[model samples]
Target: MKTAALSVSSEECFQPGLIPRSPRLLETLLANLDGMVYRCRADAQRTMEFVSEGCLPLTGHLPEALLLNQQLSFEQLIHEDDRELVRWHIGECLRQRRRFDVECRIVCADGSVRWVWDRGVAIYNATGEVEAVEGFMQDVTERKEAAQALQEAERRYRSIFENAIEGVFQTTPDGTYIAVNPALARIYGYRSPEDLIVSLRDIRHQLYVESERRSEFMRLMEQHGSVSNFESRVYRRDGDIIWISENARAVHDDAGTLMFYEGTVEAITERKLYEAEIRHQATHDALTGLPNRNMLHDHLQRAIQARQKGSMTVVAFVDLDQFKYINDSLGHQVGDELLKTVAQRLLSCLRDTDMVARQGGDEFVLVLQNQSGEAGIAEVMQRILAAVARPWPVGEREFHITSSIGVSRYPEDGKDVETLLKKADSAMYKAKEQGRNNFQFFAPWMDTQVSNRLDMLISLRRALDQEEFRLFYQPKLSLSNGRIIGAEALIRWQSPEQSMVAPDRFIPFAEEAGLIVPIGEWVLRTACRQNRAWQDAGLLAIPVAVNISPRQMNQSLIDFVANVLRDSGLAASWLELEITENVVMKDAEKTVATLHALKSLGLKISVDDFGTGYSSLSYLRRFPVDALKIDKSFVRDIARDADSAAIVKAVISLAHILNLRVIAEGVEDEQQHDFLRENGCDEVQGYYFGKPMSVEDFTLRLRDEAIRGAAGK
Candidate 1:
């Protein structure tokens, strides 16, 4: 922080009679002990007419000798560089008859440098003709140094304000963006500050996504005279919403009248994302991306508050049965996929207005708003059961898992969030007791098992290690050949100690326990390895498809798949990843990224259970999928049902239009197979041919097929 040196010389002076002065006033001012006062001719060389006593203190020259136009005049004391400029200023002021001020350096008689401020005005004679210039001078070395320092400081601040990384803004009291630095304009996605000002006339309405945000802002301003950490969702110029935080204050005038507000706006999109992820970690199931315990409590409370008369809110507690044995025996990888699949199916069953939350390990709570008592709740429960029962492809297998749903209604079950949740949870046990894949309304007698969740956890963990798991593969047939093309891997568990454990039983539990990440990795590796073994045993290298859980499909999945392919020595084209519709829909961009990454490794990507997911036709083209596998539910009735047939046909046409292959699953008869093949299905898989088999059994069957083929040739 350095500044240029500055000073004023005596020859630089110009004086004017802008103010009428009393005769004695000038004499009294000159008598004061600090600086000199003088009058000089407005000429090339300033000729002195008057000088004050203070001249002795600065230049060691007496006033009488300087004032009488002596040989040692004011111009002689000025630094040579400044002498002419000072006279020029005096000449201009005299000719213009205006006030003048100048600063320059002077070399005193003692050879010391001094800074001075010369304030002057033009002196005119009674005839209104220019005569001379008169002014007062001060030894302003200290003040001049301070002024130079201030100018430098202003320059630095101005530079930073213009080139700052974060946006800075000054707004009017009523929330209009008055002035915004360049950085702010960029942050708001505007081309320039002028454009931003012209377009964003009303910040509260134009910038904030919600109108009520203005009220919140005003409230904060009123309460605290300022606001910090004030976050709101706002729109960029292109209407893309982002989050920003403002540290702002109300600027007031001298009398405390409100002038305007000035604030610093930090584009916190990245920070907001990080904060949201942290919040997600705290209140969401890491594996399923569904709300967890803490968030569920908040949702329940909100539901209770929104409860309407006659139309009661319903809370359904869903628990997957037999999930533990599948996890322990087959591996946690299969278990995690089961949970993610279940979560997705549950989400598909509910409306966007409803809430589907995972309340830790095998327990899911759903909030149905304004339902018409038990009947309304029953329909939802049935849909939940159907969705859970629908076949899902796991690794290289296809299996089914069932859920037990317990319902509790507002007021009838309990009035409070916790009470309703507790009742619904207890009733879930009743559904489990009656039979899996059924729904039960809350009853007072079912309270006994509500507090036994710990026991359920223990049972699940034990199921996994006890070798209760089994694999079920659904057939995939070539449409042209009428032959099994491949199979989708699925898993099941039959527990000796517990009759049978469903995937829904322990999948959620493992996910909530953070065991899904490792578990999912295992499924990928195991399925790939199993497929490679089948190929090495002389079976046609059909794509062995494995479902990818969302948690496993992120960044790490890319590396994991590449590693598994290397270890198994399998070509990427031989492996297909069955990703559900919902996973791709959650974050279209990120999902596209994950799909591309897998695709880049030469693996085939298929949209599993295609019709059952939230489909955005616009984004379908962006997915790096090789095929769309129709859900079993659609294929189950595609042969006889017109609507199912229509949907199936449309999906096939759509898939073909997108250059994606179509595969039909759950074709239980020849008619279904004929219909699928006639519709140009690239492949078909279901009970029509064979169910899933062990790796050895599958290889033996392939050998038999090859022997048959050779005999026919």
Candidate 2:
């Protein structure tokens, strides 16, 4: 480690003689320099020959300690790791007779590492031999550390951009892509980030499905400088539309100049589609795919609003006639199909401006908008009636059904949606009361009728609890024997307020309200008990028939009848069950089964008003019935009208051929009685025999008739 001695002073190294300057001024200049000025020998030890005053601050060592290698050699101050590279660089420069410059690490006297820049030249002697190297060295650690920190930050930013799941992007304000990550490319349906950036040059036209969305985005950005959860529909690279949500901010430089827009994008197409489906299900009926009641209310309100502008809007409530009978008899499956068919027919019958909505279970509400007057509405209503009446095939059979439509016009019928619907419903019930299969315009009178019906329904419920109903008996005379054989048990509602409520007054409503099931059961039990009581009192034991509605037939009628007969101790033969032809023809198969069941229980089953319904003769043969009652309409004119008389004769002949008895109803006069008696009619029951009377009156009449008969015999 032997080193050369210093042979040069600081003044000599700075060449004051060549510059022609004072030593004091030169010393002051060197002292003020940012780094140490030095001369070193061309040796491995690099012995220092001259050192400036700055050497104390730069190297944390005194100039005397550095000069002449008094305490430490300059080569020893060089960092071990950078010493060889520095030597090689300086050596090559000296050989080429040029100045040398390099940056390397150095160890300060305090043992802290410093980055240093060194610049020097080989000073030559007169014979071209190397004397020493002159140089200046300065600390550059701060600049080097700053550059390293920047490089590390850039690496971290690149990692985040590549790995993020949400799309990250930077775009110029002019809509050109500045930078985009892989996630952004995937969201836009591109193969790669480069492809997306290259292809999507115009974001407004190429990205947004609606051009206005882009404008909106820019407006929001300008106003608030950022947008969060901004949703919009945009086109993917493949021309498919998708929903996207963006959270973006306008990036700016330190001087507040706009640099670019940076944002994140999320694909939300699946979520949007799911939300739409849920909305549709909420507003649509599941069975018929029609607008449901909720949607109908909204639609009707809108229609009323439209009508307020001097135009009429008709709200029609359509109820399918006999739909419940068909539904209960066949099954709910057929009912649903029938409703769908009705909905389709209703739609076909109306203009495109109209709407048909399902108000649940065989009920539809129609909105006819912007009508001219009654004529226009009437025509549409008629069309609806005709359309609904058309025969439709269900399963293996072609079924015919009808609609009862009630129409309430906006402005004329109350002002609001509920009022219009209420009035329309009331009018619809009137159509049912007027014998169904028709349409009725809402009249103010219908409101009172609706209220009365409502009151009656309330009373009917109370009547059941309070025993407000009474059974009246009408005698049936045997036309062959000229003797009373049996009686028909008819129900009478003796209201506390009204004297009597006829069967026709509340029967239809009770059926519609589903109260008939309970009421029918009550009637059966009471009629059976009364018949057994008459037998117990030593009156002639005769069969008493109780009318059965279609609704009652669909229930457990056979079981109910058996229970009644058991509880009343009346033989089933003494309690006949009467069913209308329409009820039997509704579902012939089910009716046949019910009839057989009753017959098995020894109850007489008669088809009442037989000629009124369209019953197939083939199926009629299959019904296990004891008798067929000629409809009152036919019997009312049987004596005078040849057609009625001929029909009655044919029915009696047919009944005899089938080995069944025939009863002619509504026989009001001697001519009618003689006509039925001469025509082989087995039984007769009507006002002619006697009007339906209370139990006590009928019992007294029976006693008087028995006395008179005994005397006549």
Candidate 3:
């Protein structure tokens, strides 16, 4: 067997003893080396021929223990798991005559595990047979542990990116996506993350529904470098629009130069819709679906702002005329339907720029923007009036309703929204006062007039509570015999400060203020109690009639009357209730039902002030009345006015045909008395018989009348 010759320069090929080598230099170099330099035979248990001093620190073994395998073989130091692999690798490298490198674990003398990198070239003889292996072994445990840790951290991050609920994304500053997770793809309605990344090239155009949103996003990013809860509408892959919220930050390098944007996206479409619905409910009326007072105030404020820019706006306050009558008589259900219908009609009459809002109950505020003066406003007002007046069926019958609108123009009718609305409301009351179903523009003088009316309303309510109201009775005489049959009770207010206030002054105000219900109740109870007291005092037993206003008829009048009769201990036959002709015809069906209920209590029902309201013969026939009282207008001029004379004569004939007694009111002179008596009138109540007087005076008059009747008998 022969050995391969070493390839070296002649100057480098010297023996250590001949070259006079420095022992300290060699020892210093070898001690600082990371691993032990070795030469060993290629065997199953590699036989180490020589080893460096670095071996002591690397394997915790002395060089003598490893040399020639006298104490321990180098193969025994290799970890059990890597011994076979090490032998196979070394064998293959020796056969191919090439250098070999491998990583494996080794057990130190202390029984501790350490990872090492071993590199060697095969040493061969002249015949190409393996002789030995020479290599350096270095401890690489720190690098290996660090690399494994980095790999574990990457695995966790990838797992989180894949499984997160919120969409995660990385995009360039120019809105080009670099990476996207599955959640991001799902939010964008795409099949996969790769598909989204490929299809959405320009996020500004392909993702955002509005182009301006991209600009806004850029602006925010430039200003703050980050945005949290930035909400906007965006388009999906399917082109369906949805709302999304993003929390993002501009990713920058060490030099503070923007590299890309990384963010999270959340589908907030459902939340956005819910917020919109909540806003609508807050600003709109529940029943009529019109803008409510809150929204109206906002609109009016805007209108006022426009006025400052030299634009004219009309604030029209509309009130449904006689709505309370319909509400009280028919029911609130019908009233609600009527209000909804009115709202729709008002909307139809206005332009898109105009707004109509419910100010609450039968009252609506209309805003006419950029109006061209009175002419344009008038035209729209007329259309609204006509639309509201058009007959519509409610329940089973057709009903016709009208609106009284009051308008106040901006700059001319005060400056602010509150002032404009106040003026418009004042004008609406003027329209009502002037005979409703019309429109009125605000006038400065209307303020004083409305104030007076308001004062009267306050005073009237006080009078009712203070028991300052008194009932005055006027004797009703039989036209044929000139005998007292009954007395009509009239209300009068004896104010503590004003002395006396006429019924004409406060009654209308009471009706408008909704104070009439309680006042009417007081009048009924007082009148019935007086009548019962007179009969208990052994006076006349003639029935006493109480006038019922139209407002009173809308309430539970039958129940009130029944309660009054029961409380007063007066026979129902001795109490007669007189309702106006117009009241019964307002809601004919409801009135008929009420009249029947009242008549069932054995009370006499009379149609007072008849022939004034245009009552239909068909509905009038259904009324359960015992008497019909001719209105004062007809009786006042019966002797001279041929129209009045004919109406009175025909009324008597009509009453006779219907089996009802006819009574004429306001007969003040001899001629009026003669005409009514000659027309076969059953009873007459007027100044011609006797004027209305106080309770004490009426009691004395009743006593004298009773004595006179007894003398006549």
Candidate 4:
């Protein structure tokens, strides 16, 4: 492609001889100049005398059109908006024979405007004749646009910096306040930004409530060159401390020297308080305000880790035995208050390092660290039992509750948290079975007991199939009348190996394995059949009582007893149902309905283990019962313990007032017998009278008693 160029003339001698000789060199030089250079004649309309092809791009007009006057004139090319200004600057410079400089906008042929800086010198003849002018016009559009953009961005940034909710600032390395926004002034309790910069000279001593916080902040910034989410408490202008979170970065000089920090500061006192509340809610029980299970697990884990060398760690499950009675009788609000009091008493039983957690409901778990042996565990357990058994004032009445503790140790009973908890729970059951208000240590033998229970559970099903279970009758003597009145049919297991299994050892197993339903049916049928046999044998007509488990009592026991009596052809008066205090007190309304239904069949309902449960006199009176069997514990200690004697008298008196007969159990001596007789007890049955006997032995005793009565001996 061919290009065009021009040579400078003597008439336009502004830097003459600067033009290149070769057209290509001229073209290259002009294109690289960034603006066009032009020389035109001083005509009525200034005509282009010599033009560089660069003019085509700069003015958006081809050089040929301008040179031949086919395009608009040069003066007319100046934007009309600024033509007078440009012409004035050029005319004035020529009249004074000096250089001219003007900044103006020129309209291109494409109608777009360009900003240009024009600098020119006027040339004249020696005789002072009119001459030509020459200048360089360079584009200044890029610089103009960049300056405008910078201004707009600054405006927006300044608005945000001033109005932001968080504090914004720049601080020097030496802690001097360089600049602060308006929001910072408001946050720091300053009247204005200048007031903060002037008054708060020492950020470490003046701003921070704790001076060490400043040292920490500076140390972090030095190490990382930035600190994000840096939180601290600082004093405002009025000396009130508030929490703040910072996000900051270091701003260095051109040489990368440590300069200053620029950052945003947010007030987080409210959020910090909210987070603390959430943490408290997470760790504390809502009802009792005691430490909850989450905190307990955490404390237990910590205690396990901090266990002393060569010492055992004990984790105890402390459970209130009859708490449900109180909860169901009273209201939940009262229950909550009672639990709180219990938690306080439990906390008093342990050291500060030990934790007592409300493991949900009326159950609590405790962690004991560095115990010497079973002795240490026993001591803590006793303390806990005593503390919980202390009388509590619930509403108007002074209520008392007892706790059962199961202790599991580390390295012996269990090695992990879950195992320890399970063993502790098992031990707790043992404590409850031992009549609550006491503690039991975790033993390797306890594991054997559990394994035996599992083995019994598997064998119980087969035993029912093989008829390995049998019934033994324990006679309940009428102490007032001194005659055979009724008998308790106790279930016993005779293994295929001819081993006699205690009822205590296997009854609980059968109940847990769901085999009691069938075994209890067998006992009922056998007892009824034996009672019919005694009637046929012409012996004294006595009702044979059979114990029904809580599980069995949950079924239609009234209908079952009626069916058994009908099948065996035994009168309803010849069969009686014996139930424990726990079974009756579990669901009082249901128990009352069941008892009434059975009483309608002319069968007697007797509560076993009386004075041993959380039965209220109000609920007891509501039961359709004929007899109350005093718990053996009270009878065992009636001769020695004054409390036992008083309890026995109270129970008998209460039973009589309710129109129920009272019977005493576990009378092992003449002293116990005399005690019961003196207390006005109506019946007594224990080892002192006769131990539980097999069916054949009881039948033989009946025959012997009948012979003696027939002779009136």
**TM-score per candidate:** 0.47, 0.63, 0.62, 0.51
Q: List residue ranges in candidate 1 displaced over 4 A.
A: 1-55, 60-103, 107-112, 117-157, 160-178, 202-205, 208-233, 245-264, 271-275, 301-316, 351-354, 367-382, 405-713
Task: Please report the TM-score between candidate 2 and the true structure.
Answer: 0.63
User: So what's the TM-score on candidate 3?
Assistant: 0.62
Tell me how far candidate 4 lies from the true structure as C-alpha RMSD in angstroms.
10.9
List per-candidate RMSD values in Å.
Answer: 15.0, 10.4, 10.1, 10.9
Cα error of candidate 4 at position 456, Å? 7.1
Model 4 ranges with Cα > 4 A deviation? 1-57, 62-106, 117-138, 156-167, 182-195, 228-247, 266-289, 292-317, 327-337, 348-351, 367-399, 406-434, 438-713
lDDT of 4 by residue, 1-713 (tens): 22333654443333456653555555677667768777766555767766666677788887776673666788878899899898888888888888889988888888999888889886676888657777788788888778779998999999888889989999998888999998889889999999999999999999988889888888988899889999999999998988999999888889989888999999999999999889989999987788898898787878888888998878899999878667644645677888888889999999877878898888899888888877777777888888888888865678889989998888788777888888988888788879999989777668776676677788888888988887887777766766777777888889875498888887767865778888899989988998899889898788888888767876877788889989999999877788888778777777788888889999888898888766878888888889999999999998889999999999999899999999898889999988788778988888887888998999987887788778886
Candidate 3 regions exceeding 4 Å error are: 1-199, 218-226, 247-271, 284-291, 308-314, 318-357, 360-410, 428-441, 476-483, 496-499, 547-573, 577-691
Per-residue lDDT tens digits for candidate 3, residues 480-548, read: 888899998999999887897789988878877888888888988999899989999999889999888
Local error of candidate 4 at residue 87 (angstroms): 12
lDDT tens readout by residue for model 2, 1-713: 11112233455546544755655666778778998888888988888877877788888888888777788887788899998999899999999999999999888889998998899899899999888899999888898888888988888888889988889998999898989999989999999999999999999999998988888999999999999999999999889999999999999999999999999999999999999878978999988999998999998887777665778989999999988767755666778888888989999988787899999888999999998889888989999999999989865778889989999988888889999999999999999989999989999988898898889888888888899989999999898777889999999999899989898887877876778888888888988898888888877778999998777776777788888888899998898888888778777887788789889999898988877756778998999998999999999898779998888998999899888999988889899998888878999999977999999998887777778787988
Where's the lowest-lDDT run of ten residues in candidate 3? 1-10
Stretches of candidate 2 above 4 Å error? 1-208, 213-278, 286-288, 305-354, 358-413, 424-446, 592-597, 616-622, 640-659, 670-679, 701-713
